[model samples]
Target: MDEIIDFESLKLHTAAGYIRASNRCFTCKAKRQHCDYKYPVCSNCAKNNTDCMAWAKGSKSPIPRSIACYLEKRVAQLELEAHRLRTELNPEHLDDKENIAANLSSKPFSGVCNSEKDDIGDESFGFLYFRSSNLPAPFDCTLHSSDRGNIRTFMARNPMVDIYSIPSKIADIILQNYLDIHLPQYPIVSSEYVRELKSSVFEKRNTCGPYEKAVMGIILAMSTATLSYKGEKGALASSGALFSYFLSQILQVEWSDKLKKLQILLLVAHYAFSNPYAADSCYAMKEALRISVEMGLHKELDFDHISPLIMQTRRRLFMVCMNMARHVFSVNKRMFPIPSELISFQLPEAVDDHYITDSGIDLSGPPTKAAAIHFYRFRLYETEIYDVLWGHKSIKCGLKEWVQKMSNNLDSWLSEANHFSTINQLKYRAICHASGHVRLYSRSPRKQWRNREDALLLMESVIKCLDEYLVNASTGWLAYLMAGVFHVEELTVCLLDIMWNESNWIFDHYSQAYISTQVIQCIGLLQQFSLRWPDIEKSKMVSYLSNLHLKITSQLEHGFVIDPHIISQLNFLIFPQVSTGYGLDSLPEDTVDLDHNFIQMQQWNDNFTSSLSIL
Candidate 1:
């Protein structure tokens, strides 16, 4: 080497010097300051140990490079001493012995680098360390060392597994923890923030199929609406508006056409009763023919699988639609009249012809089929004609005259409903219409009626039909709607007066034996209203209240033995009164209040049941 670079000098000048340790034990020789040790090994042993060993071995050992110069000087000195001794003793053998020693003392060859092997081992140890990955990142994210350390420990212990391998134990813990924390804060996962969380998780997992995701998104949106609408009126309207926003988002992001169409139809059907405005979605929903054509889609959405609770919700939703439409129709009919020629006959003749046949009219007669041609036709056309006739005097007069003449001829068909069987059909259809009307009608008061007289007539006919239809009726949803209609007026009064009033005698004999959970809840709430009724009304209205008290007492006593109806339940516990719990942070603090009414309600019911038991 031009400069004869030393290992010591190189170590001192290197960039790695900052990280170097100068620890010397029994091997490489360096000075006190250079050696990283509490007690330094002396320079003789550290620097020349290899050469000293080689010299001591004479002809048997080879010199090491680290001390080669020092070893060579020593070897020369020894050879001189040997030559002098040989001259004193036997000079002849000296040359041969010295040559033999020179031949034996050759330098040993060394491998490239012994230290590199140790570096590789250390690197492998670091690469395998768990803390180097998940733990270190989280730790570095935090400013405080202690905080970082704690979080690092947590993450190290709870590494995220692949979504497919989500253990039941982990899932349970996560669900409980999530519910315990977020249920109160979020209340509804459909909120923008929570949905973002769901979306983020979904993306990261990459586990959900496109169709599944689309279905899941729709389910999430609908569930949010359903939960929110529980205690509110105009539930469909409120839900429909929210769903439209969900639809807007889904339409843009979700590309699976089949799922997209099915989801749209569901949204439409879901809101159909509540928001006729949702009918505007028909522009998109006509694609339902293509979207939901698969048999699997029907299986996934079977009416048979619909729960009692959902059935009730749907029936109520339908009732709202029908009632709203019927009320609107009644109003339009009262306001105006259109000419007979202008009315469209949309009902099929077979269906139209049945009404006339039932009305005891022959289709052969020129006068008209009394049921189909006169009453049914009149009923359908009257509203539209009246709408047209509102501004025109001549049309109004002519419409009025026509309506009167039509009414006279229609008496026979209209009166046909006076028959028991016919009355039942009319009542059934009217209730169905009432249910549907509740969805479409606007809230503005324009002399609207609940059609109390017609409702009372329907209720009377239902009671008459009950014994015959009881078993069959429970299977269908119509009875639930009928129950809802009967209870709506009572519900209004109970809310206004803050007390329950006894329903008429028909309810007493109706029996809870065939009652569905929806019916039971309606009864339970009404019963609760009676117990919580105003104290002022209690003493003064004792005679009026007697029936309610007796009815409740008798039912509670006999409910197990006679009716055994399972009451529809509300999960009040999930939505609690506590602050700093799930979903509560998002709720206004002032809105939290204690419910003491139910305690008294339960007490009263228990007392009444006990007294009845004694009797």
Candidate 2:
């Protein structure tokens, strides 16, 4: 065999054998190319700048039965030991017992996966996975993770000043303003509580704890800030200083007392809604919901065993919590934190504060009906509608059927509104009707006559609502507060959307003018709102409306017979682009002139393209 064999031939033979062996790395395999059989990494993988994974010999062949069985047994034993150790280390790791039960009821795994013949895994693993799926998502997990660090930093940087520096008479006046204006609408705290705080603060009594004082201070600050105008600059400054002081104090508390913390949060959230610092209201609502859940307010309780006063208090707190959650969700378009299915409590009884006493509620007392109860019920119905509109449930019916059902429900709700005779009730009913119209319009086909009619009607109703609110504002504070929080921004958005529907053949010059005028009216109302609450951050909404207005007006200026293509191309040029820093003061100067040449060129190109198409 020592016969002379050529070296080149031998090397070629070896390479051919290697290629036939199919021992390429993962990258080469994926690329479907021949590998150099290099150690660590193949040549093709290296050249291509990819990770190379070596394939094991005979990996495609199934393992022997004996070895597979042994491996499976070993894995099972390891998993069991790990689970046991975990259980020992943290016995209460699965503390959400109700959630577990719900999961088990909803998603029970068949025993086939882990029958006597095959031991796949423990049931706990499946439950754990299911629970994880049901847990609150990142955006929805607003409670557990808050802006406490930021708040702390703010407090550290801005040292609080003495709130008592304001004149006692002015302070009392502010407190009374809040009670008269905001209390009728909110009623989160009892009048007795306010009176007590007022007496203590006026007398300079230290009987009130820091938390109570903080609550009172923030209430007064919110009231003063909302009711006052630019003319009362000094009072506004004092209110701001008082708010910071109280907020700093409130931030220092550990928030261990659930009820007290909830009360404080509600007041803060209300203030935030009225002030420039409205962004934190969602976080406050989330925290409030968390506290309500912890206190078992969502769950139905045995009223017979509990005191009537405590029961009523719990119901009222839960309802308020729901209202706040609904408001935040509606505005942000975020997933609601509290599921309605989980709520088992009933609506709060329509009773006056005098019916409640230190001993207990006077259950035998005559039910002094109030508009607030109707308001609460309306909010509850609103929440249900919101859930149906936005929730993940599958609707088997057609759009018309769904719309009809919802409309019927809304009509039923309105029918009951006649029973409530107060001005607030009338206003609330009008708002509800306006909201229903908007909701229906939102869900309906965009180009339909019904949708356009709904949009027009909504704008009209909203205008009326605004007019009534503004007129009533002169009479009391509730109207002003309601107007401040009213969903005018929503109406503005709807009007803009209607204008943007270029597909609607029905859209004409008159329609454009009318919609544009309505939009301006809405913006004008918002401007009035900004005037009323100058410190509040409404520039964003105002800026958006302004930009929309500019767009609509520009379209109108161009006339309707112009080529749609040219209009489409020139649209961006007509309106000044808004930035995130958009404000009344920071608005960009008109750029229509700067883009004149560009628009002319676009028009020329459009004419050229149209001529070519004709040819």
Candidate 3:
């Protein structure tokens, strides 16, 4: 070897038959901390349990101490990221505020809109994470770890958690919260089982069977997610983690039947929702979809031996999975989801689980009590406008004909849902828009210009519905519903895009009065979203909308010349990183290669299901 080069810019000095290297290690140098630089490791790195700099470079890595330090450092980094995440997610952070984000005072365009300069800022968040200071706090993330190594080393320390118990009182709260909060998102489980679980927990002195305990653990994880969101995650900060561990343990049981195993997978997916970044639930979601297809829930008459009650439950589960699967198949991701036509199961009854029977159900005058089963029923009725307009192997007809057909169906839905509450009306309308927004966004540049008017209406409907829905909504309730949709940001991008260039089209059909009102409403809604979701700040959504607000107020009103740079920034779509890096991150376009692949997969699935029907 030519003078063995290693050790972070090592300097060897030979004076009177002695060689000396810098005492500081690479990590210490980067962090501006002192390093002892011991052979194969540093004393400070060993004490702190961080990866030694010498080991960072794999070539002739540091000794065993370096390996131990590296693993420890990773764990520390994870814990630090988790603990600090919740505090940073506080809706009322110091920097973000009310009054249409006045705190976001960094301007993107300096020369333009000097009259309305005060309102805008360089608060560009790429898509999800914002460029902000990484604040530290207590560990408020899901999956509570108790032991610095105590409760943390659970699987290695304790092989099984068959008898994990909390006070019956707390268990009761968790069950209720699960019913109220978690069920709305995933109404797969039966309410009767939960009732029985409570009775067993209380009467048997909190000693429950493995299955009941598993249910309790998963529910506890979801309920405490709310607590963490509210910043009330005191000692139970890691309760979610502990309970998740329990659920995972339950999953490994040899006796877990097929249905029970599938349920556990869904429950795991449900718990994964607490993370709020990336599609953490995607793998479990896909697994659940696979199992549902294997069980033949996609076929209406395949399971003749199964009781109607069991069949209905399976139908509900499979239909819900299909709904999740459709959304999960995004740009660049691939999956073979069950097609809508192949899915011919009866819509599961909306009645409570207890009220449902093996033979039949009574629908006495009006059928008021709506349960999770109603979600599938509702979707089946409307048939998802997006699916009709541009679904897998969509109807090969004139686009106008199908568009009119879907529009007529929407009219029918409005007529039927006339009895809906004021808030429910707003909620449903917003949802309908969410379903159709992709279609509303024009893919071709020509169609983009052609569809500007309809797209504007879509934006208006989304914001208007959201505005009314937020009238008196609490944070917990908001989290329950809003967790699923990102309509606000999507609308912001569309409106900002329209404002950037389509002024001619806008003013042609609509008046100055209309344009001004829409911009103001968009700004207001974006501000609300920024306050509600921390990701809004990081993604730089409000920044783009604020620019729109400025363009309208200053350039449109005061006759200031609009700058090309502001338009460029809005379309640039590249936001800053926390320190000094930037990258191209964006929402998926209307169509992708995967979408066509999905169509091909749909054909295969249709053939597969047709063959199964013959069997």
Q: Give the number of the best model, judged by TM-score.
A: 2
Model 2 earns a TM-score of 0.59
lDDT of 3 at 416: 49
lDDT of 2 by residue, 67-102 (tens): 222222343445445544432323354343323222
Which stretches in model 3 have alpha-carbon errors above 4 Å?
Answer: 1-185, 205-211, 220-256, 268-279, 302-304, 327-336, 355-374, 377-384, 387-397, 414-446, 451-456, 469-476, 480-485, 505-615
C-alpha-based local distance difference test score of model 2? 0.50
Best by lDDT: 2
**lDDT per prediction?**
0.28, 0.50, 0.44
Better structure of 1 and 2 per TM-score: 2
TM-score (C-alpha) between model 1 and the true structure: 0.21
Q: What does candidate 3's lDDT look like per residue over 230-317, in tens digits?
A: 4533313444355545645464455425566567667655554443321124445544654554455566765567777787687667
Off by over 4 Å in 1: 1-345, 348-487, 490-615
Candidate 2, 405: how far from true, in Å?
Answer: 5.5
The full ranking of all candidates by lDDT, starting with the best, is 2, 3, 1
Residue 76 accuracy (lDDT) in model 3: 42
Flag clash pairs in model 2: none
